[model samples]
Target: MSSDFQNVVPDTEHKGLVGLLPAVARPFAVLARFDRPIGWWLLFWPCAWGIALAGGAIDRWDLLLWLLLGAIAMRSAGCVYNDIVDRDLDRQVERTRSRPLASGAVSLKAAWIWLAILCLIGLIVWLQINGVAKLVALGSLALVAAYPFMKRITWWPQAWLGLVFSWGALVGWLAIVPEFHWAMALLYLGSIFWVIGYDTIYALQDREDDALVGIRSSALRLGDNVHFGVLNFYLMALSSWAAAFWMLRPHWLAIVTLAPISLHLLWQVTTLKSADGDDALAKFRSNRFAGLLMFLACLVLGQAG
Candidate 1:
């Protein structure tokens, strides 16, 4: 791992898609985390949830594609921005020591340039959405800008990340309708809790390293109660989503739409191995499936209901 990142970063997928790129391009890909599809998937699902639950139209499936591209670009830009802000801190953490910036595989100038390029892609996505959705998307920038510093001031940085990530719900809903709806707000709220739960699971991997570096996280805040805490957060998410479904369709059938994802989240918390970093990572990654299930449920509610 000679500052080249050719050997793969610890937390990244081993020899995954990034490896297929050329040598010089590899570092940039890792910088934006192109190797990790999970990041973008998590971001995109919330947008899909907003769209589908807002009454998905067949023609608007194109919007899903645009939103997915937006998710990839924006999530990558956020990762680069976070790495730039956290590069020194990353050096102190074992899991992130080999990150492109931390390892000097990518320079600050290059990283910033890469971030701008990613944002350019996001700008292209902005052209596809309606005016109100664009404004909603803009509102997330402040949250994104401040997110890297959250660990310095609060134990609930994941909550802030929740606010930032779940923002796509607002964008998705607003894209469909010019006005706000209570159901959309609940969907967004549920997504916030969902992010907090999964990201807390993600933070479990960095617990020791984070404490050593004085980085605050929900995992550290909860300590022994991490499992219970995650369970409660998931429950909140499910409850909020159930309420959302009920509001949208006002039927027992709509509530039934959420059963699969609810059971999947249950499996995650119940089977979670809080002591093992690998298990924590697996549980965190499991959110991709959870997001998919949620999307299907929202799709069913919006279209079939």
Candidate 2:
């Protein structure tokens, strides 16, 4: 369908409301993904994991709210920045051509203004955390700022994004407990691989266009064996989480509680179809549920311990 039809059709009828938002905002709202909440959820999960793992007698409802806001704001800002940098490449892709910045609906300058506003919101949220968490959050800015350039320079841009997206694990953990814990660090590292595995699947959606435009991605790097590569990454993610769990809880039940999450990742790998881009995207989006399951596992174990 043309952008005209896409915009006129109410997003209430669409499966992906986010794409609709960019289409309707006369394209400006795309800067904030008011249309897409999945990115925020993906961004929010690590923070949730950190918060849950840091469980004590502490109530952090206020901090959680701030993190949620920050997730939405920063995720939107990151998307806007990415669109601006990749506008040319985006226009070449079927799925992304209609994006605000790529489609000429929103200018680069306008998008930058929107990005700045979102960053301010993120900064406010950062201030709400402890000094250590604040520093950790600040450290992520460089990663966020440089992410748009990664695809141009490396075939593993998704790996870089894993680092950027999972930084919240550290920030959220340090917020509740100022001390460093190797177990938490391992968990965060595991989450990073999970992001890389899923995001690589997402990147497959544009692999054709990406290659045509000289954009590098793990999907293209892995080539026909992309499925195997993704499987290996997921296995690594599961192993990392297992190590973290053993370190933190060191109980048979804690390990058993994580079975569901590992099985879910296994299900995704065994059933996934890399030849079909839509299939890859659907599988990738399903990680939101995967993250939730893992978070629940962490919450249950943390409370029990």
Q: Which candidate should be chosen as best, given TM-score against the real structure?
A: 1
- In lDDT terms, how accurate is model 2? 0.81
Clashes of 2: 2
RMSD list, candidates in order:
1.4, 3.0
Give the runs in model 1 whose Cα sits over 4 Å from its true position: 1-4
Q: List the residue pairs that clash in candidate 1.
A: none
> Cα lDDT for residue 291, model 2?
86
- What's the C-alpha lDDT at position 154 in model 1? 99
Q: What is the per-residue lDDT of model 1 for residues 138-237, given as tens digits with 9 covering 90 to 100?
A: 9999999999999999999999999999999999989988688899999999999999999999999999999999999999999999989999999999
lDDT value for model 1: 0.91
Q: Which window of ten consecutive residues has the lowest lDDT sum in model 2?
A: 7-16
The lowest-lDDT stretch of 10 consecutive residues in candidate 1 is 1-10
Give the count of colliding residue pairs in each prediction.
0, 2
* Candidate 2 displacement at residue 59 in angstroms: 2.2
> TM-scores of the models, in the given order?
0.97, 0.91
Report, for every candidate in turn, its global Cα lDDT versus the true structure: 0.91, 0.81
